[model samples]
Target: MTRRPRVLPLEAPLHEAARIMRDEGIGDVLVTLGGRLCGLVTDRDIVIRGVAERRDAAHTTLGEVCSAALVTVGPDDDLGTAARLMRDQAVRRLPVVDAERRPVGIVSIGDLARVDGLGPGVLAGICQAPPNV
Candidate 1:
């Protein structure tokens, strides 16, 4: 899991979120509302929901573009469980949280492959996939 995952306030502009992703070399950012996890915004979300949809990104907030239905994993979760969750949810990344649901880190399929030896094909597919829809 990647500790200290990037987070953005719900009101943050899409342009700023995109900037963060570019600078951080990440595909997504966790969206927070009042210091609580609320949603996730990805590069694909920016394009499909922001640009292609013709929304003014400078004025649009992360909350408007982010996905609220989150599929997270606990820090103690086994790799198999985590993998299953990813497959079931069709998500490439999973936020690792504490009991309080505070995000402590993030795990991507690539990370799983590196650490747990998930299949290379799975890792490649996830790495090649467009950011979370």
Candidate 2:
């Protein structure tokens, strides 16, 4: 899990968020509203919802593209729980949150692939797939 998650306000520009993801070498970032975790946005979201839609990145807001129906896990939740949530939601990532629903960290399918004994073959398949844009 990445403890220091990249966070941005809901009104942040889509292009700026994409640049931050590229610079941080991360596929997703936490989106906040009034200093609370409100949602999350991924590279795939940017490509499909922003670029592919031809929405001006500089004008588009994270609130317009982020996954607002969040699938999150508490900080103390077990890895199995996290995996189950991911599978049930068909999402690749989950934001670890605190009691107040504040994002504490971020976890991805890749983070569990090896430790969960889902071999490299499976991991590679997931990582190598192109964005569904």
Kindly provide the TM-score of model 2 when superposed on the true structure, using C-alpha atoms: 0.86
Q: Which candidate ranks first by TM-score, i.e. highest? A: 2
lDDT to native, each model: 0.86, 0.88
Error of 2 at 108 (Å): 0.3
Tell me model 1's lDDT, rounded to 2 decimals: 0.86
Per-residue lDDT over 1-133 for candidate 2, one digit per residue giving the tens place of the 0 to 100 score: 7697999999999998899888867789899987789999999999999989999999999999998999899989999999899999998899998988788998888777746564577775776566554
Q: Which regions of candidate 1 fall more than 4 Å away from where they truly are?
A: 118-133
Point out the worst 10-residue segment of candidate 2 by lDDT: 124-133
Error of 1 at 45 (Å): 0.2
Summed backbone clashes in each candidate are 0, 0
Give candidate 2 misplaced runs (Cα > 4 Å): 117-133
The number of residue pairs in model 2 that clash at the backbone is: 0
Backbone clash pairs for candidate 1 read none
Q: TM-score of each candidate?
A: 0.85, 0.86
